[model samples]
Target: MNQWLIVPVAIPAMIAAVLVLAMRTSMTTQRAISVAATAAQLAAAIGLFVLASDGESRAYFLGHWPAPFGIVLVLDRLSATMLLLTSVVASGVVLAAIREWDTRGRHFHALFQFQLLGINGAFLTGDVFNLFVFFEVLLIASYGLMLHGGGPRRLKAGFHYVAINLIGSTVFLFAVGTIYAVTGTLNMADLAVKVPQVAAGNEALLSAGALLLFTVFAIKSAMVPLHWWLAPTYGSTSPAAAALFALMTKVGAYSIIRVYTLIFGADAGALAGIAQPWILTLAVVTLIMGTIGVLAARSLPDLICYSLIASMGTLLIAVGLASAEGLAAALYYAVQSTVTSSALFLLAGLIARGGEGRAPPLPHGTLVIGLYFLLAIASVGMPPLAGFLGKLLILDAARTSAHIAVAWSAILITSLLLILGFARFGIQTFWNRPRSDGAAVQPLPFALTAVIAGMVAALAALSVFAGPMMDNMTAMAEQLIATQGYIRAVLPPAATAGLVGG
Candidate 1:
């Protein structure tokens, strides 16, 4: 077992514990510790990604315990990529938060670190039960973070967020329970071996379990009908907290790719293609709703929230295809969407901080408007940014699918709507806005500005290196479709002998 596999989770857990115990009263100390810890986590995640890119799958068994019997953490290209995404987004959000949000409430740093611990753990865990555990951990921390700013709006939104996720969590447990009841194993690798061997009579029950599990992920991903909670919850939270949450939807997307591909993919006999049609129909609806939401948005934060929904809809188009090309494209879009959405969230906070009612013209009017234009272009899938490339990949991948016309038309039309809508927003909020009456023109925090700018620069770099990035995503997608290497790495040969014998 490689030691580096656990570093992403362990480092954050340790740092969070220290902050809670020793530095809760020291905002400066908490900020310094958090920044250093996130930077280190980013380093670890990058190292894991490099190793995974070499096409080898690695699994770490806790306390030297073997798979199906003990806790296991696996690092493959997809999971590694998610880890890297989380760490990078976290670093920027932490910097933005430390400027002011961190000092506004108790244990902000501690909760933030714990949140990372849950997210990283979710990415690495190999068992369904532990995935649920990590989900709870992250949710608990998020509950605290959502309420950190202490406004009536924040409290109201936080309550809804908590209630909805609690319900989702309950559903998740039931899904896991159903899976375990039928498969007799919760370890994902073990499930890959056991699912195909399920008795013919039990196939329906197993499929139900899988679909139930997907519903939990869909809610987390904010799929329509299940997506209504997102805009209000995210729109009302403090900017830094909401920005950090930009990666949360990807966690749901990631889980769908992992579980769906590994356990219920083409190799799973009766279960193969069970979810394809459902996902496709749901994805189209999701896309439409996202566009509608954007058109209806009353404020900048609300617009970005709708844009995130649209982005997730775009990502699911690839997932619905359930092919190597489709999954690869989805993965690419996932990265681009996560980073861009987070940057927009932070930028929105900077533009108008305290209340969402209206932003008095910012002191750095030119800079704020400039950043808004860049983010708007990037988020709406304009050319030369990663968002454009992401949509192109999805479009190209969708061309061979039966729904090509629908996918192309929806994406293109929505892109236009988004551009028009954002243009209107830009005019009202920045160009034609009334100046603040007697308001102080405080300069934007240097750290906050630098972090947002860095995110934009990173987006540019991703575009410049699109070819190599897509190549890696293609490999990761191939790995996802082929589960043999992943299963072999987690379970012993004898444990899978029955699966192979079949």
Candidate 2:
């Protein structure tokens, strides 16, 4: 079980190859294998999550290679949490796609598995270079998924998506190269140990590299100004793909949290928190713009896409607080919002009319409407759901920050905007529209409904067990802030000294 750190990546990689090479023509076979692999992944992730709950960081050196030199997968509370989230989302997304979405195009099942491989690898890798490699893996797979249910709109959006990511990839390589050249290592643990000791002459160079790294991550996370690619891309993609993609941005957020805390953390001397100053300010702007986009949206997919951005804004604010409480809050919110975003995207597929531009609402009868309202309330951070609880944690964390007023104002005001946006869309979707006479109304598919209910149920469980979840998150945050534990866990004993020195 200790070696199962690679399960998240290996399971997907192996199955994806099998699906591509052998099961390409058999939809039935592909569906069966893909579903089984995803369930295996979920089970493995759960095992890893329980293992990580002990709070000690563990490293799995690949091919028996030592840390800071060869490939490694490190499992800590954060990585374990993300792995679980990815596996959970993949299970639901695959289930949703099996019915009709995967049949829309060739290789969707393979692409989806590859997407999971990339996402899981991104979360688990201990090397910065491998992180970039996983990023490419996921991005390439996403291109195919984005165009799975092809349309002229998807083609156009996919092109922009590809082009934007290509630029980000190029920047990512440059940043990795710069960091390696300066620090003499690409391993995150090694970098953490070495960053604090950088010579004064190299401080500026390292700072530039660090900031450049954040730039790439910000692009991947869909931060504002760079967020132009998200709405168009997500809105055009199929709902199942879009739902899975909700985890992709978290890859970026996870990278930001990981590198900033471990490598450029408070102990990094001159390089301490190089990316900190930009996070909160940009997060606020991001939330505001996303809120505006949500209100301006004319279609369900488009609206949900913007709302996803707003949720990112809120999540990042907790992250930018640069405190243990903030990290805990951000982690909690990340889980909640990820599920809520997926739920809304799936709901969009069921409820919206099929066509381009300003997709008028198609009545989805009772079940879908009920799910939509439930998700909408959850998405808008209304009470009694995990979304609301996550936001409250964020606000409480922000209370101690010097930027308390700004954080509160931004969160509270944008929350109102989110509610208004969801309300406006909901009224048009469920309330004001008149159903045609003598028209046959199709009931929602039980499978899709069940998949969605599972996600909602996860959110409900988070709310129901909010205390225990937050307690774990707090311990995880403590582990994150105490960088020495990670440094010791990954590196040889002799190497850990002086690297984590504050």
lDDT of 2 by residue, 1-502 (tens): 5588888899999999999999877889999999999999999999999999999899998998888889889999999999999999889988977775888889988999999999999999999999999999999999999999799999999999999999999999899989988999999988987888899999998998999999999998999889999999999999999999999989999999999999998888899988887988999999999999999999899999999999999999999999999999999999999999998888777665333323443444576677888898899899888999999999999998998998999999999988998888877766765553435445456677788889899989999999999999999999999988888888888887655243
Q: Estimate each model's TM-score.
A: 0.97, 0.97
Stretches of candidate 2 above 4 Å error? 353-364, 436-438, 499-502
lDDT value for model 1: 0.88
Q: Which portions of model 1 show Cα errors greater than 4 Å?
A: 354-359, 435-439, 498-502
Candidates' C-alpha lDDT: 0.88, 0.89
Worst 10 residues of 2 by lDDT: 353-362
Candidate 1 structure, TM-score to reference: 0.97
Question: Model 2 reaches what TM-score against the true structure?
Answer: 0.97
Look at candidate 2 and tell me the lDDT of residue 152: 99
* Native-to-model Cα distance after best TM-score fit, residue 306 in candidate 1, in Å: 0.9
